[model samples]
Target: MRVKDSATDPNAIAVDSPAGTASPRVAAPRTGGGTLLAALGVAAFSLTFPATVWALEGLGPWSVTTCRMVLAGLLAGACLLAGRVRPPARRHLLPLLTVAGGTVVGFPLLTTLALRTSSTSHAAVVVGLLPLTTAAYSAVRTRAGHSRTFWAAALTGAAVVIAFAVRESGGRPTTGDLFLFGALLVCAAGYSEGGRLARELPGWQVIAWALVLCLPVASAGAALSLRTEPVHLTGHAVAGLLWLAVGSQFVGLWIWYRGMAAIGVARASQLQLAQPLLTLVWSVLLLGERLGPAAPVAAVAVLVCIGVTQRTRS
Candidate 1:
């Protein structure tokens, strides 16, 4: 989540040392393509909150969440089948399940429900905390060391986000705020787990397998939700749903994992700092949400804290 310099050289090939030598091989610097791919992934993800709000105009949150996951699962199944990838080993099964539950079920469902009451602008600002959360999860899972400065910056960023949430909710936390907080925590766990898995498997394969693993539950939920809430799909809603299914769920993760694998998670995740601003823009333009003066000021403060966190190291 905290951005760092790329860990390896994408263009470098491993050169064999002398037969008796035990020197480790060094990787070349990463290419510019990795940065571009990461940027594209962030761009796709930035629209998610706003798009969910739009889709909710014509469909219930449960229906929208379930349908999006089911659709994305179908596409993931197709990719796995076409790629002729074998099922993951037993050790990987649990991590894959974590990814499935976190990204496919927890994050989308909670955020969809959250948008029912919270404006996209508020949600976008709150999402500014994701990079810090993701970094914390990654550090914990990997047993990586971090400096006190890093912790200080991350905590400050999180505190700023919490303050913004409180201000937006009139000094009291709303149900939507709780939902969004849950979404943030689960999504951070998923992103960290998926990044670790991407080192062992193809990035797309990791997500595809996770999606396929959750297919049965997602399909059932979609059917049950549809039965309970009659869907009246409008043009805007359809477009929003399609974007969520294809871009946010599938394409974004595919490119994101590739970028993470190529440049390392910390460096690649830095690109996500742009997501809140991009989401705010989408909310204002596409969803016609009005931005208050406090929004920009809070966003800048959060971004500054994030930058500081990214630059500090263990």
Candidate 2:
């Protein structure tokens, strides 16, 4: 979000090492390639809710959660071995653990739980505010400052999303909404930390190592869940599970971190302004899930906030 104009922005922060030392700052990519990468990442992520719902059709939420994590971790482990990537340094472990806890475990589990009750379109719109949440986290973690205008737009966006949530549930937030909000918060933390970590290591390495770090616990959870959960695998379910593990969790993350490293977190996050809309389209086209009229309105409003925040971030 530093917008590659780092020299003019005194509040810009370099991605920090765990030893409390700042690493080299990532420069903005000279071409549109970074934007393309980020856009692709957003595209991959937009299908997440639909895919989770598909997986849930045949697999229990617990099984969906743990199985995806296990599969992703093994995939990541293979990538590390194939590339002979070094184990992360001792100082990197804490942040890596944070990444694993937030993205690999917390976000996946929470969103899957949320999907149990929430329609894909509903969940997608609620998650539309993630970029703002992530930007706020990034600013706080890096001690970056934003103008009043930036904060105002962010707040308005949050308020709009909140009102939408209440309206969706007949004046109260649903359990699914609560779980989606939790997923939003945890996933934001994971993303901010991962983007920062990517500055010090390859983007692929950052996510790969984080996924690998979750292997022991994820594997155990998968085993336990599989034993108890009644999984009647169907085409949609198997396809959904594979996409969750490979597309969203691994390949998408790898692409996203690289783009974030190149374009900076806040700037790269701007691409996600389209994600909810994309997800909405997918919900209709792929899942035959219809959305309330308010969904598009809320999405457009949030998009405005993101646009304003992007302009005012400097």
Candidate 3:
């Protein structure tokens, strides 16, 4: 998880093109609006897991994930058509393919599978480790300077969350929890790399190519799953699946990646902290799940960890 701070890199403000109209250039200043928008994106995504779980009662996880991607891809394709976004250059095809597989196909498949056994709370707890995982990956990959205190705090927070989740899961980690954690680690890598690519490529274009690249994989998965387990159609299930496909996947991502491109990955990721908290809220309101007495405790601890990790000199 990263924040999209323009303060760190003035060059990221805009992409200049030959057909451009005259535009003014200036030093990137801090904007509270970016943070606010990022917060909204996180809030939207927080509803995603619980929404998936709720929808999953009727639609299977694979079906749900596939449908979501398919709808999102189509929506993105439409946007591309309307905006006249160009296709990727031949040289860029391979890198785009790699990101498509990692970000769209692999991450969603693993996460949807995880949601099958794990409660929304369980998944949230594991995914809350994303800040640590992302920071570690960034440090190793870029050799970026970050504080030891930040890492220590992130590590401690992750440990505490894991401990609580394990206790909640009856001392044994569920397959779902493990899958969620593993997916977070893998997806964070893709997200970091993809964000780097956004420096040279348009945000929607990257995702458009990725979704196109992922279509075959998603189609194959859908075909295989549908062969044995036909999706039973019910009104509630259909409605839920529609929400997953259109609202969560398509609408949510359109805002998310665009915002990430406009800002920066680190700052964009700061919005991610809201996801777990929103999941908790949705679970309580929609699913009637209780966070028990540990809700406030977990909330405070997580916020502190995020604050610690966010203490960057850059």
Candidate 4:
């Protein structure tokens, strides 16, 4: 994530162009095109919480989570097979499992459960801390260093979300907040690891492999849950399920990992600073959730913090 200039940092991943040898203007492109890709990925991910809410209209929490994974896994499997991708080497298995456990199982299940009790707007703000958490994970795992300015900004962003949660919940966090915070932790770990892996492999391959690995378990869970969960299958519910499967889980991660590969993990993550605000707009427009005045203030505060981190991170 915080790749020291590849020239100086021996541990930094060498990013070669498609021809195997790359241009010297790596830094320029990373800041430009890479940032754009990450921004697009953020836009895609912003809809996830609202989509999950819509999905809950017709499906049980467990059913929605499992069904979402199953569908994404199938799509990922199709992509892999179409391209005749080779199986991952044994060395990649553990990290792949980590990715699958966190992104595929942990984040989705926890957030879905939380959505049962939480407003999408509230949930969006709570999960807004993800960029800071992800950058922290990337720093630790990669043993990269960030400037004090970067840490200060990141911590301020986190503090804003925490304070907002407390204020909203009458000085105490709710069950939904707890679930979302847990989702925050695991998802950060998965995202940082996936970003790291993306450097060595194609971005899509990383998410695809992780999703495919969980296909069997997800399918089984979905099948059993379908028997127990009441379902009405309204247009909103079906559309939400389709978007969650294809848009958020699969395509979004694919784009995100590619961005992480192009830029560093830390910088790409900062781009996610705007995600919560986007989700807020979606919650209002799509889900018709009302937001208190504090939500926008906190969202804008977090957005400002990311601006500092992007400029100061080194």
Candidate 5:
């Protein structure tokens, strides 16, 4: 997920950054550190699906989702308090809520639910669409115009992802597939909104504030989930849960949004093209899942499409 500034011209394409912040425009040069930061963020996120799967072995999806949020929120709150950060301006409240709803609530819940039925490998393929979705949301939010080549590349990538899903599921969509798709959309929106706010607020602070904002809801949900499901935590499950709370939800966004703020959303988002491949590797190594011959082919195709889309001018 990412955020940035809006364009003055309705037809002009601009990357979202904080107002008064400097970020590379589409044609501008990108910094090496920004690219590396974005890559690191992707590497962190790549483990999310598999980790969630490991977590589910000992906990219900609701338990994992809500507990992760509550824990991460507490960490974020501590960060805020330690930094002595003032509350956001009243005007910033709604966007922070948007970030909270999509990422803090929607993405984790939906993906965890999806993982109940879907393999980690399949979910990784679905998540491959995230960069494209984030780009689309950024385009709409910024009211930016895209060239025909850009749209064609974006549509082509979408088509490839859809086809891969269909082929994987024996030509029929599964419940997990639907849930993962929903996760992709909501996460994209959250990323875009958070990236936008990162311009004015520090990237870490943007997610920290969003997490803190949702703490009450997260606490309630976690309590209710535990009451209903009664998780018996194992060492692996505990590790998985902590990874989600600290690595993916908190530190990952700290790096990701900063990369987006520095390099612009478009370029930063492109780095996520590597995410699916990394996820596939993690799934096989960590989860002991076997990769089919088709998996690598699909991953390469998706990466090529993403590269094409990234190169197209908006």
Candidate 6:
């Protein structure tokens, strides 16, 4: 689940540092470090949604969400146990829990279920609203000055949804779309809060502890679901599950948190503008989904919104 693009990508820590004339000697190393980390964060983040969709082909969204968090929790916990990283302080528990509950638990649960009925293309289109939602959230908090461009971008994003309904197979979104929308909203809120807190906490510590808190919750949900609905395992399913658990959940988050820490929340969220576009690309490639006439128009609209959000924030 994409949280609002954060300027504080936890992963960017290794890469970026303050420019102080007093620290001239460290400049070269900091620059190199920031560059590498930023690159890695970009690469890792790009794969998350596509990987989620790929995993969905085989595993139920609930199972995928549960397994990914459980495995990531274990992996992160092991690293923490080995002194590779440390846990958060007692006072930080609430924030950590919030991040875990919102991102690891809420977003995945909703997104997975959404994918059950909606096409990945539609999911991407709907998710394109995240930036706008984040902007709207910011508007509520800061009441920042607005512009005509801002409203235009916001309108375009809304247009994407309206367009979808017009072309919608049954002339309306299914129940799953509503579910995904709710999940996406939760995720937007998570991004806002998580990015804010990430400024203070180390990336690994946040993810590790957050996952630790989320593990039992996800596990219990999965187990209960399993009783009523048996998981159908296929070769694709097994591979997708493992991939999401290992790649997106464990490794991807490790880098993501780091990126959040390095840059800051708002700026990092900009990286997410790439995600929906990438999803569109992946859908065409992997799922054989077509873009049709709406493709270019949607692309322009999303890009314009991205620009609007950046300008408004800047």
Model 5 stretches with alpha carbons more than 4 Å out: 1-30, 161-172
Which residue runs does candidate 3 get wrong by more than 4 Å?
1-31, 90-95, 167-170
Candidate 5 local lDDT, 268-310, one digit each (tens): 6766766766787788899887656676776777678667755
TM-scores for candidates 1 onward, in order: 0.83, 0.85, 0.81, 0.88, 0.85, 0.74
lDDT agreement of model 5 with the native: 0.76
Error of 3 at 300 (Å): 2.2
Q: For model 3, how does the per-residue alpha-carbon lDDT over 82-133 read when each residue is reduced to its tens digit? A: 8887786675676676566656766677777988887777777655666567
User: Tens digit of lDDT per residue, candidate 4, span 154-271?
Assistant: 7887778767655654564456878998999999888888877776667899999999999999999999999999988988999999999999999999988878777777877777
lDDT of 1: 0.74
**Candidates by lDDT, descending order:** 4, 2, 5, 1, 3, 6
Task: Name the candidate that leads on lDDT.
Answer: 4
Clashing pairs in 2: 1-266, 1-267
Per residue, candidate 6 scores C-alpha lDDT tens digits across 1-314 of: 22332242223223212342221111112323533454465456445566777776656666678778777778877877887555555656776777776677887778778777876656664555665665455445434444666557566655664464245333555667787778777766666665545555555566677787777776787686656555777776676667666666666666665554554444445456556666666667766776566656766765666566445533
Can you write out model 2's per-residue Cα lDDT over 1-314, one digit (the tens) per residue?
A: 22333312323446445567666654444425766777899999988888998999899999998899889999999989999877988877887887888888888899899888877656764565787788778888877677888778777776776666556545644568888888889888888888777766777888899988888988898899999999899999999999999999999988888777766676666567677777877887888866567877887897887678656644
TM-score of 1: 0.83
In order, what is each prediction's RMSD in angstroms?
5.4, 3.8, 4.9, 4.3, 4.7, 6.7
Lowest summed lDDT window (length 10), candidate 5: 4-13
**Candidate 3's TM-score:** 0.81
